[model samples]
Target: MAISASVSLVMTLAFLLASCGGMGTHRGTPLELTIAHINDHHSHLEALPDQIVRIGGVDTQVELGGFTRLASAFRSYEGRDNVLRLHAGDASTGTLYYTLFKGRADADMMNTICFDAMAVGNHEFDDGDAQLKSFIEQLHTGPCKTPVLSANVHPQRGTPLAPQNAEDYIQPYAIKNIRGIPVGIIGITIKRKTQDSSSPLPSTSFEDETSAAQRTIDQLKARGIRHIVLLTHQGYQADKAMATKLSDVDVIIGGDSHTLLGNFSKQRHLPKSAGPYPTRVANRDGKPVCVGQAWEFSKAMGEMNVSFNAEGDVTSCTGQASLIIGDRFKRKDAAGKWVAVDPATPQKIAAEAATDASLKMLAEDAIASNVLRSYSSQTEKMQKESIGEASQALCLVRTPGESFNASGEVAGCEEANQRAHGSDVTQLVAQSFLRTSLRADLALHNAGGVRIPVPAGAITLGQAFALMPFNNVLIELPVTGEQIIAVLEDAVSSYLDAGRSSGGGHPYAAGLRWHLDMSQPKGRRFSRLETKDRQSGTWASLDPARTYIVATHEFLARGQGGYASFKPIYDSGNYVNTHFLYTQAFVDYVRAHGKVQRPAPADYSHQAVTTQAGVVLH
Candidate 1:
């Protein structure tokens, strides 16, 4: 009887152990939550580089980053006591994949990866509000269930923030229960008004980021949520400012900046204090905080492991940002021979083991898939397509101090001129169009407007579309010759400042070449300025009183390129879509002359030029 009774007791204890994770004091211990995160995927669905990374002194080989490989990794962590998968933002742009599918394939892939929540990036609005609404509908109605959250965006007067599923579309915050501890997440986006005009953000207003975050944090605290994570589309400096100002925030998983934080040491800037304050401040409950972010694309995943006490306060934390390199990749060495290798463990491993067959198959599939073939295939299928031709092979490369007039000079012209524009490829195209269409004295376009390099080959209609993606119209403005000189001086100053120049040493211009003094303040860079008339073929001194017709893109004419002085230059009636004109010109030129000759530099005389205190050039 005693032996039988003991067996029954043992059976009952075993049942309890299996049901409640093995009894004792372990039941009350705070759960360990592991969060795996990535941000700014930007439609890179292919497997990235796989490398062995060192995290907290532990070397672990991360082999893949495709949605499938990420799926496998998620499955491995499934059934763990606590785990969450998340992405920061900016998953909607940057590649042929995004351009083709308009974020459908990306949504499907992200759904497969099982993302719990995502912040809306500025690019999410690139296709306009209606498309963004459709994307939201697909996410909500699709097989995968996840919430797209943005706290600051408020719809303009008539447009709805979200017409369908308006109730469940977005929330200021979400609370997740992990082992009896509640984790609160707050989502915010950068103010769209401050963004570049190229971004297709709706006319809706976005609240100030810092204020919005503080209000949300206060609300979360009111609900008794102690642990907070801010999922923000604001850039790195903004995130740091939020972290320092708001002590309630526990961890900031941010995007938009595309910053890579590989380890905790790389995140030394966190726990920063505000202003003159030295010591790190604490939340209302008094807890230290951490901030982290992953670089853009599927190139990496960020992992942060934090231990909290019974009070739901973080005690210790370790972070690792793992880079995802594709498998079976062969890199050339100094001798230029392809060799089998492991980037992490370079010494010894089987050649077969080094190659990941699955990843290789994926790369092959991406290349073979029709979706990846051209960036416009899917886009054209969705909208009414138009056919156009290119007259000139629009080349996108620009050399420093090069101007648009170089094209005319290259075609052979003398030093006689009446306007000042620099030599650059885009400037050349703009100048050619101005002279051919409107007979303008000077032509101008913002350096930022020219996006990609127009490859010297068969210029497809789609290629032209991509080159001038932004639908901006051309406008002719009337400005004094002095104002034109001022604009040229600004461009020259930008050329000398390594940080300000967009195309490295290259600063775009249309008419003239003048020496710049790097040592002086920006406005004083020009030491010599001269121009030549196109028809007269004789050199002329610039008449400060003469009103010159300047052709420029609409954005610059509106004073966007830091050229506030140009705002006073009123626009003339000869306005046309710059893209349309360029397309027509390119098509005509290409059709007429099978080959487009490259523009060469012009020889112009500038007398002795010198800067303040005798910094001279001849």
Candidate 2:
């Protein structure tokens, strides 16, 4: 009584079909399935530079990623047997494309890529609930509509947190048939408690992932579906723990952790199987459970091939996580259509690509492209190209003191400079978009939000966009003299005293400067606070009682980056997306002044004050 190959395939397919209520099956005949996935794209709609990414000791050049190339690759996967295209999360934010388009272009790009489904990452809420709803609306109404799933989000008691028009656009779980095999897909969102408060999820909350996943798994089991797949926005550690606890789950397609799982490894509590498996650990059901993820951006696509038995459980699987590099070559057809040839081949790269071509093209054209280009063209048309020049050179450098400061003051200082550029750049572009609608003001950016440094050169619109990638709204909040001191104290205690150094150290100030006494207790670090109104030209004491309209990134006003005290003073009325606003401001400033100058040495002065710890010094 030997099992025939066709019989086994038929049984597996039957089980899979039964699991999904006979909705659909894979396109191929071999009964083989391949899942191609990307995560944390963050709207990096460009082809990046090539770089060496070391994976399994094989060094290769990965030319980086672009949405256009990704679309081509995804289309190639179509008409193939058992191919699934998906994204893990963080599809919006972190790049210029998102900043200029407010996620509309990214959504279009995703539609072109034909993503089957995506989990909701934390950054999806960076624009807040209202914007998120709008994005959902667009996706629902768009031509290339895909399912979005999240089991953890709970609506508020009164308000319609989930949009009515987009209800069908989102689901907690989906069951699909792949090559006659029933596969259950479950989506999970990140817990808001662990994320920064700046996430734009008002009146909504997240549930416990493990509990929510357990319920979904049980529901799928009741439906007779056994081949389970989890599309999760939770990070790697959480995924590992969930796998250990939830034995019924077969495969966990994860994001948010951004770990490069080049090959399948064994699970902790799972057992050894009779054949080769993707993971080291086996589940209680004796099925080989696998976990996979593709790092942020469309830099790479993850592929996993799994083989199941008559029971519809994964038995053995072999696959490699492949990174897709974007390369374009111009060629002519017989009829002379001037087609764009894609040079992306599935090769093992030693490093990821550094350049993003899609972004570069957008920069060069600045109009025909998506939102950023449109904004740039508008700015140029209005002759808004320059902002106030640097009085002196402000370059990001790491000093030794950065290692010792509580807030990583040195790092904070350097990052502040970086963020100033990022914020200024984003603000300039955003301002350009809304030139006719709103009046521009001094661009203010939070040091904590700046993730990278601004390279010195003829700063392109793209360069500024990379620095201030988060599409945070600009907020003009009025804080009394007492609130101002409280905010400064919060910055010192959380940033200076608390040893969390980002970038270099020391918080960078664009239009303000002050001296701090580190030895003083947490709330008493700022010994002197001063601000120079660009108009006044003279340093003025920050009155504790008088309210002043301060421009800041929305993240800071919402008490993100450890500045919880400022939350109370957050003014929702004056909030606007600074992406176009600031860019326009910079363009106007630069055009008016021709060549800008960095601030002079005298513009910024600092001295460490003595405290109980010692004569604090930097």
Candidate 3:
């Protein structure tokens, strides 16, 4: 919460007051609107765990982000004119709070906070359409039903969503009064991501993103709604691109990609910047459009001031992406230098040192605190209950392949040789998926899903949830040998060209084996590609004509996370949803095999064919 530059405490109030006839008619002077936004809350209802941040280039741990701080930050603008509170979605999944309560806790919190409207994020459909509808229906059960919007999603006729849409629970756009002005807020979720990567029902379909947005804008403008805000679940870059294309959108409050949009140069405690706050881009008519998005996990809240002229064009806009961090630990001296304390220092000063952290948790907003305590107490209890026990520490890491990242991760052959070929945890999870697969030839897993590393101790439900947090379903897609090889190459493409693919689609598998040469061309990197025979469990060379049932999660099976080769099956509706959660498979695997020990290190079946590169690194 270090402010490199001083921002007005009464910024929202100032904008509101100035909007209410500071001089003359609205036509003569610009009409002002204040938008307070949050996105990617991810069910982090209570205060987040203490995290380390670079403060003035020094690592410092501070307790940051919670529902209370967000509420407190917005409380200042209560009852103010020309002000709207909007959320850009992703208010689901992350912690034990979501695991125990589904989205009820999040609904309750957002119900109380009472956003004017919210976009439908991709993760909202993680539990399927019915659960998402149920979660939305649970919101406070009062007049304060937040407008849930997604213009591109068109639920088929006779579907639950279609009927509800006719009932007004889901709509393309909403018009709210900002002071006396009617401002149209259109919400759009990323169509492709939600369609392919999430668990939306089969009947739920998506239209082109750019088309949906423009159509909605035309519809709104036809109704004489000029001041428009697009609350979008699209990433920051997409928003910028939309700004350049759209003719009517005055402001965009965006989410997804969990991007931080602001100047963090002076604010050491805040996240690094992706771009400037209110990233300005010209619309189709070459007029400026303002785009603003807060960072993820409720760590920050965005305040954007937009002034519109009589023609409904933006005159001026300012966005403050403020990190809602609590006051904790100590600060540097007046000269801005961190002073190290000596062992012989006086008792009083030493007691007040950063090491002591004398000032524990900072004060939180009363209303937010009350709500958080109610649900947090139950979640905490659920988090502590033991789920299983590990025989030994199973080291969990995202990347286990070292040679694939030689430039960054490997200093020499020794370093590359020392790294594990594959993560025991991911491979274990893949094996679990295979065990649960009805009759798949093999099972595959992406490294990104393996979140928290397991320590040697009793594994709790919370720990397991943390490990595989996403509510991804198990799916087995039918693919030909060539398609499988294409995706395998796609998975390793990032490794082949690290500059283009930092997180190359690394795959961990069970009932399958392959040797890869990183130095070869992207498509030719893999060799000895094999899958286990379902009946005899014998590794056999992939047959080009054979139709293999490849077990994978919904995300990857839909060709997300760099596995575009599987997308053909998904697009053609040739995959089967095993109706099992990904984590449950791992849980079953652990329970079946009691007291799992630290796995023996295994060598990579694949490595860079150094000679193929025609060069040598010292």
Candidate 4:
């Protein structure tokens, strides 16, 4: 009996990697391989709102990054030979797509692209091993049969990932054939981060990253696979560091820090790149290792073309990370609102996109779009359910007195920033966190986490999701009042120095207040710090020696976004994972209150602000 085409396709890339041996090949056969990859899609299946990017030397707005657009981009490389389509990880747990449908929606969208392999990101364990197992099952239902790879992870017997003594649910590596050249792609998840921060099974354990990786590499080399690629979920910096520690690691595609790498000198409006695309570093043997990462939220895809000699050593690697965007154009109107531009604007933009190496203009792939449409309809129906109402328009501002969305999304937002208090929405979110966790004395929130302003009208589940878009859970940390002051200083000094996003690092809190003097040095920048007693509702000066429980999201608690003081405390095993979803906390708060309004002036986190230029807003 003859094998069908589908069966042949599956057989061509041998999945029986453990038992495979070397095959005869031409010694001098040079190869050019193109790797198409994405990371940290985080269930953002739909297109994001209008984003401002530099187009034609002007800031132009366009919709960016959807799975449908990614599907189209990946399909564009079909005609090319020796191509590998990969996803680094964190494909689930962010938007309503993951919350309502779980991993099924993410699986459906991923099946559209049919990735060759995917790494195991820490967020995959957010709901435990059973949910991840279910997701992997859905991913396997399609013809791709993409292998889930994580070298260091070991599931104990009877765990969901290792049920009934089965060990094939997640493999250490996968073998792929590129034009008769057998290559090994290994997966390495961040070890300690997953165990400490995420909800993995207690019995399941992860090995030290460097040791496990080297063991896997040696095994592949023994099987005569020389071209090695590591699909890792560790942060970009960690990936670069790990590259130097290992041998035979020719290329690394990574995720988890959401670090954007590549030069965007022409596209000045895009977020700054952390490093050059394909950042080259020397391996242990002084050989080269190329590292690349696409930005978060499906905004970009990385294409790295590696040229190899007969020995399978990478001679050169080059490519660009292109921002996937739609042709539809929008620009700020006279009223400062984002509105559709003239029809000719898109054509002109598309013309420029043709020449721009960093931008790729594309429309949603029809098949992927159709697949998303069914789930999107369900999402829409559920999101429309009313939760509560806002008594007034709560302006969205990152920093007090900074003109962000003043006349645009929220009318009269200009007046909202006239005072020293920062974002009303952010403070409200902090209050929700504190309220949800009764053990905490204060709630701290990053301004960037809260996405949109609250209009003075009905608030729906969709609006709540829009408010807190990340999959961050609430955690309580016990720290001295002194550490609280220092953490706030760290947050302010991070962006105050320059060349950073100020709004995202700005801190907002409930049951706490502070007077900030931006003109002062880092430690001296904050003064008049006070804490409110929950029972008496009386404010008193924060005692630097006193221990206090602080409520914050997992991101900040992990020392991200310049909250350096929180990490050590969290690592000390003195912290509590409340396991309360942030968005759900807001929903619960709204349901309990029936309506929401801005906190009183005395309760605002930012009691006063003295700008760097000596202007005070009070």
Overall lDDT per candidate, in order of appearance: 0.54, 0.56, 0.72, 0.84
The best candidate by TM-score is 4
RMSD of 2: 10.8
Range of the 10 consecutive residues with the lowest summed lDDT in candidate 1:
270-279
Number of the candidate with higher lDDT, 2 or 3: 3
What is candidate 2's lDDT per residue for 436-538, written digit by digit as tens? 2233222234443543333333444554455456655555666665776676667555544533333212234444455665567876666566666666567
* TM-score to true structure, per model: 0.63, 0.63, 0.74, 0.76
Highest-scoring model, lDDT:
4
Ranking by TM-score: 4, 3, 1, 2
**Model 4's TM-score against the true structure:** 0.76
Cα lDDT tens digits for candidate 3, 145-193: 8888888877765666666454345688888876667788988988756
Candidate 4, 1-618: lDDT as tens digits = 356877986667665442465443434678898999999998888887667677888678888899999999999988766999999999977677887887899999999998999999988987778988999999998798999999999999788999876455889999888888887899999886676446688798899888989999999887777889999998887888899999988999999877778877887555457889989999998899999999878889999999998777889999989899998888888998778888767788789878888898898999999999989999997778999999988888777766334323354564665568878888999999999999899999987677678878889997788678667899999989989998999888766764333346789999999998888888999999999999999999999999999999988898766677888998887889988889999999988999899989999999999877778996
| Candidate 1 structure, TM-score to reference | 0.63
Q: What TM-score should be assigned to candidate 3?
A: 0.74
- Of the two candidates 1 and 3, the one with more favorable TM-score, higher being better, is 3
Which 10 successive residues of model 3 have the least lDDT summed?
405-414
**True lDDT of residue 563, candidate 1:** 48
Higher-scoring candidate on TM-score, 2 or 4 = 4
Instruction: Give the poorly placed runs of model 3, Cα more than 4 Å off.
Output: 1-26, 54-58, 164-167, 266-272, 330-362, 386-428, 434-441, 447-459, 470-483, 486-507, 511-581, 588-618
Off-target runs (Cα >4 Å) in candidate 1 are 1-31, 47-77, 160-170, 192-203, 263-287, 333-507, 512-574, 578-618
Candidate 4's C-alpha runs over 4 A off are 1-20, 24-26, 332-339, 343-345, 384-426, 435-460, 466-509, 513-529, 534-537, 542-582, 588-618
